[model samples]
Target: MKLFHYIVTNRLCHILSTIVIAILISTTCHAAKTKYIWQSSDQFVALEQQDSPSTNTVAPNDHPATVTSETISAMLSSLEIRATDSDKPEPLFTAVAVQSIAPQILQGLRQASPTEDVTFAVIGLHNTSYGFVKSHKVTTGRVYYQAGRLNILIGQAQKEVNDRDDRRLAPFTPGSRHKTSEGDWQLLPQPGQKGFSLQRKDWAAFSTEWQPPAAVQSVSPQQSIPAGLIAPARQPSPADRLIVLKELKEKGLISEEEYRSKRQEILNLL
Candidate 1:
């Protein structure tokens, strides 16, 4: 009887071990199967409303202009790259963070400084595509630079008038889009602020509140340009244009056919 009992006990232990092993294997496989997605702070699509003129052309103070330009250039140069089995790595600039040090930097440069009460925020927008057969939410990953001011808003108007395809009113207008500022186009609001909430919300008042994240300062090459010099308005070079096109494609601003056609055109120029 003792021998029989011992054998039964040993069998039970084996079965238990097997079950434990199977569970661990299943858990491991489940974990391995999990997919990762990059999420941004906000998402938006282009609106159908007739385009309106932009009103955000406050001549930036020298200091504010310098700091913002440097911040933008550094942000672009730091495009994330992926390693592959080749000499060249592919760039993955899907996520971007723009922090504002305007108030801090400006105080030292100019006598009359921007009010200390003004707060700057970096907003991220995501463009969603429905599927191959149809389009879902049109685009994502739109960045808006908002400055909380006492009286006038600085970045509001220009961001509103631009279309999803980055089309803008002719140059020389009050809010006419400039080429050098093309890099900044995405950082502005989509046309009509469609599907976007521009007003400030009181987060403390609600149980669930959305807050803009801290600017992503991760990548490298912290470079800056002199403030006084106006970035040349010449048409963007091929490489620069490619970057813009890639962004537009990723954002779903341009259809696949449009992207392909424009890409071929740019390549032909090269």
Candidate 2:
């Protein structure tokens, strides 16, 4: 009776050990399947498992598409950004003049890395209580591609309008992104706002209206001027310099003393 009991007890121990080993293998495989392709403080792009039912997952058949210059232009024109003081949102590019320089804004998205970002000036019209106002703002945007889908995040716009500097308005900032739905691209909301969508057909219209103007030649200092037609040297206005200095301070690029000194200098110029 003792011998039989000993054999049965040994068999039971072996079975229990087998069960534990199997469980551990399953847990490890599940953990391996879940990973983040990109992440930030408040946002992330993760690779989901096939069993996940999340709507954010990209379909298997939908391969990742390279973002083209046209894509960038279309995305920028479709953005519905509103200033904090404005009542209603408006397309970031309203006037043809602002749209003409869209090509110059396509930096950072075409990088070889899977994750990248770009910052550019945003010129748009906003409707205030008084009337329509033109706003020159600055914003940063991040982009990444994973598992056949593109993810984008656009930061809040900083009101950095310098009316005296036409060149500041010429630099463009690319906008945010979301999944493509029925041949249309959508703009995912920044933190506390509702999302917006734009159709592919609409992009065609925007591209046509936003054709860039012919390149202008710059006058070199070495070039000779007419005997009586010497022109005053062009320089950034005091207001423009002050705006740039303020931006540097806000970005933590300059010390308080430096910012104050530069600000005073610009003020003195006025």
lDDT per residue for candidate 2 within 1-270, as digits (tens), equals 999999999999999988867766765564365353432221222332332135554333122335566655555555555444445565544433133333433333333233222323343333334564434444334344444333334433433445564332232223333422121122323232223222321111122123332224556889876686656665765655665676567668899999999899889886
- lDDT on C-alpha atoms for all candidate structures: 0.33, 0.43
In the range 79-129, model 1's lDDT, one tens digit per residue, is 322222224332122233222222322332233232211222222222222
* Top TM-score model: 2
Q: Report the C-alpha displacement of residue 262, candidate 1, in angstroms.
A: 0.5
The segments of candidate 2 whose C-alpha lies over 4 angstroms from its true place after superposition are 1-53, 56-107, 110-112, 115-211, 215-235, 249-255
C-alpha RMSD between model 1 and the true structure: 22.0
In lDDT terms, how accurate is model 2? Answer: 0.43
